[model samples]
Target chain A: MDKIENNKAWFLVLPVFVIVAISAIIPLMTVVNYAFQDIFSPQDRYWVGTEWFESVLADDDLHGALIRQFVFSFVILLIEIPLGIALALAMPARGWRASLALVLMALPLLIPWNVVGTIWQVFARADIGLGGWLVNALGIPYNYTSDPVAAWLTIVVMDVWHWTPLVVLLCYAGLRAIPDAYYQAAAIDGATPWKVFRHIELPKMRGVLLIAVLLRFMDSFMIYTEPFVVTGGGPGNATTFLSIHLTKIAIGQMDLGPAAAISIIYFLIILTLSFVFYNVMTRMGTGERA
Target chain B: MSLQLQGIARTVGGSIHLHPVDALLEPGLHVLLGPTGAGKTSLMRLMAGLDAPSAGRILQDGQDVTGVPVRQRSVAFVYQQFINYPSLSVFENIASPLRLKGQERGAIERRVREVASLLHIDHLLDRLPAELSGGQQQRTAIARALAKDARLLLLDEPLVNLDYKLREELRTELRALFERRGAVVIYSTTEPIEALTMGGSVLVMHEGRVLQAGPTAQVYHHPASEAVAEVFSDPPMNLVNVEVTGGTARFPQGLELPLTGHLGMLEDGAYRFGIRALHLALRPKPGLPFLPARVELADISGSETFVHVHAEGLDWVVQEEGVHEHGLGEPVTVYLDPTRLYAFGPDGRVRAAPARGRGG
Candidate 1:
């Protein structure tokens, strides 16, 4: 049989190309243009190559925020991944109860980000908030507004409350996709509960775990609205992550050139880290096949 | 060791999966012969402690283990669908049970190697299940089951998923491997040839009930009822309603045969006569009745040909020795061997079984 050549399918993707170019590429090129030069006005501009990039790289405040961002992402991942898996394991496997539990678990993820932040802000206030009042009632001196540690703890807990369900949903789907035969075989093999979790459940959930980790990492790294509403990056720059810091430089100070440079760097950092994460995880997943 | 199922029954959401069944299995290979939806897997699951019987108790060597969980039972099951730990190497897959039992590392390695080599998959031990072929994957599963060294090994049509050649190879290898083990192996298959090939004892099941259980040849030669005979035949035994009276049998469509041989002892009444498809030959033999049949469809499966024909106002499948072509509506004379006809009473019990024979 002779094969016929047809390239008409390429034409079908033309609309998507046009839409992406208009939506993403155009704005990104404008940012790249700003990164390499200083703009005074629409009429007056000076091209200062590498100056903004160098200064943005050397800034001490950006470095602190970067470190804080990394620590926050790492801490949340450590807590949420295990906690989500535990909750998923405890959930009912089937019935109306399972449906109800799923809806309840998804409620936190369904809340808007800034609303979550605002909700936590008022909910953590020592004067009127129930959580804050309970902590004070227990004789613990807690105030997120003044204390740096308390603010950091509040933001972390708030993020955990908002996002851990995403992990639970992902891991639950992964756990459900595994066939019942594997568990039966494991039972017949006399595997203990811990060993079953280690060898069967964990390995089977590798794909969704990867998705969960990447999603949590990317979302927590680029966290802006929640912290902006709750802590406003306050209390001695403790909760001021990369995004909040970048926002201060871009919008508050109105320095587009340096802001664009920081934006490009931030984008590259996430891209590079996500790529590394994807490669490591995929390699781990298929390591047995190799 | 002996595993006894005492009045075992299973009902799920008001649907009966298995009726009450009682049987004692000794340390040897026993074939569960039944078609799909025949509750072979249900019975095996109950016996392996995978599912608790809704009614009765299962005893292992005279001790009740009905409520005991599958994890606590010394049993292993190989499913029709090949199941192995996808993330684990074949070596680790086989070593898993041993490690779960907290055996020493050296012993685990040795036992894994022994079973892997026995299944002819030692060279592929380092490969994962996804990296292996279907036959190799099933071999790995069987190897893992072997490494467990359970007292009761239940194989639920393990070879049913493999190709014909691979199934043949694995079936022979498994029979030998099973013979050396002391495990009471219960191998279930829908194929009658497979049941006969793995000849030890055979339990014929239908509609979740054990119709007959006896030595493989005895059950094959003398099925307790028409249902067992039907379930035990590959192409399905051709049954013809007949009236036997005055030492003469009258079949439909004016067919008649003298009741000589073992069929001569049957009491005169309405009965069903059964002849296996293999016994219904195309060529005429001496001292046999030539029953005219119209070919409905002729199917040549592999080496043998199955010629479906309408004879005596009933559809019959004739198992020819080799490839034979017959057009639709073509008339063919089917030779009925009187010595091989089984006589079943109105209640479906075997009134007179054929004389013990060599083939079939």
Candidate 2:
């Protein structure tokens, strides 16, 4: 009985564990190793204690970039969560109409992330883009290229357009997973539409919403491609988020030690925030920490 | 009309409309009895004011509630599913309606606890629906509807999801519960046993239309047609088409007998006739008349026995109370109680000449 119990089928997860450990753990260890060392060349390295971390902690550029990252994540969240729920509510519940609505909503999510950036890059241009022409025709000087506020607005709107579908799809699936009888019961209870949404739909969608928030927050925090492609950290660093600043220091200025410090700080920020997020999100479902 | 559904038929995606139901659903237990997909749910929703009936007006207490929204109608709908609120505890779910009506908190608490206790779910007061078993959840739903105090309760196969024994138990309890409340309950189910046992005047529906409606005994005794008779019993009512000629009804394959009473009223061509299993008996006596039959299958279930027999080439089930001593292939005599026999005309409607006895 003990032999039978211990006879685990190695085929079940042999390849998966190998891939994850090799790709994830080894790379993580390498990053950690690089975080606290002085590298003069690819072959030459020396231990520098917490010297890199100290410089990173003192860097004013890292601080500014950190603020920009949080602001973008918070703003994206504020715009997307409610908009996603609203879109989900508006979707048809049954028949071909529901399927068609779902397909349309999922279209944006299916597009490549970089393609989404490139499409919006052309789409948000002042001269040829529809939005630009509309604003210019309306007699407003709407040049996102030259204006920091316009650039930030463009980046936020582009991100919303590209990623709102993820939130909408998650919330829609959550809402659809609810049985029709629940709605019937609510109606029998004499709940108005608003009350039904608040008490039933809101509570039911909490788990999915929590997931959406965490996923979107992490993605927006590590946002690199879309804004990098669209704004190019332009309009005088107004749209230069954490990733852009890190890349500029590491690759542009070629400062290996301080840049390594900055990267370590960025990694720590992400790890800490993500841990907090997982705790908060996990608590939402059961109203208790596991 | 109390609850008017005039020319009510629904056609979806060019398929045939189930049928047009034009009848008044009166107050008290209106047990909608039919086979599955007889548009029972569609009819219940239309009656509950949850849905709009095509080409019809739903008049509730003589009001044109066809135009009124479900919320305005004050109708309570209890689905077959256990649909209690997952986020709310049992107490909260039961008290939600009272709070919505702006009832005082003390009164709401009193009523909620009373109903919860009445339903035997008091111990589960603080538990969410997600934590409860199916039966408990179903009881919670019933408790919630009871809290609404709706004049009409549209229970759409509400007890169907429970297991067999639990279903019967709940059915009796629900019947008593509804009776105590004096509520107009239009409880829909395709199961005839539910209609029969639940103390409701039966409304037999087939394909969305009301086939017949009366006290269970009356309807069972004089089922408007073969279809109506078929709708009343478990293992169902057995039919044997016969020829009635010159005050004589004869089973072409089995035996010929004198139809002394209503045989002269018989029409031409085939007469689709029915005799419920219980209505026909098989016992020997000195003077009593009997029909010769060959026992084809004597299915002796513990509660009841269904003796499938061939008499004069006509086949039917003879419902027996005690166990049948006869073997499956044995020859036996069936005593046909002509008074309990039902006859349908060539067109399958109940012969206006009348039937003698009830199935109850």
Interface root mean square deviation per prediction: 2.3, 3.5
Model 1, A1-290: lDDT tens per residue?
A: 99888899889999999999999999999999899878887678889999999998899999999999999999999999999999889888899999999999999989999899989999999999988888989999999999999899999999999999999999899888878988899889988788778878888888888899999999999999999999999987989999999999999999899999999999999999999988888778445321
Q: Can you tell me which runs of candidate 2 are displaced by over 4 Å? A: A1-13, A38-44, A92-104, A123-146, A177-190, A253-275, A278-290, B1-26, B244-269, B276-341, B350-360
DockQ of 2: 0.29
Give per-residue lDDT, candidate 1, residue B63. 98
Give one digit per residue, the lDDT tens place, for model 1 in B16-112.
Answer: 9999999999999999999999999999999988898999989999999999999898999999988888788999999988888899999998899
Give RMSD (Å) of candidate 1 vs. truth: 2.7
Please report how far candidate 2 places residue A242 from its true position, in Å: 2.6
Best by DockQ: 1
Error of 1 at A96 (Å): 2.4
* Cα-based lDDT at residue B53, candidate 1: 93
The 10-residue segment with the lowest total lDDT in model 2 chain A? A281-290
For model 2, residues A25-86, the per-residue Cα lDDT tens digits are 88777677777888777799999989888877787878888888999999999999999999
- TM-score of candidate 2 versus the correct structure, residues matched by position: 0.83
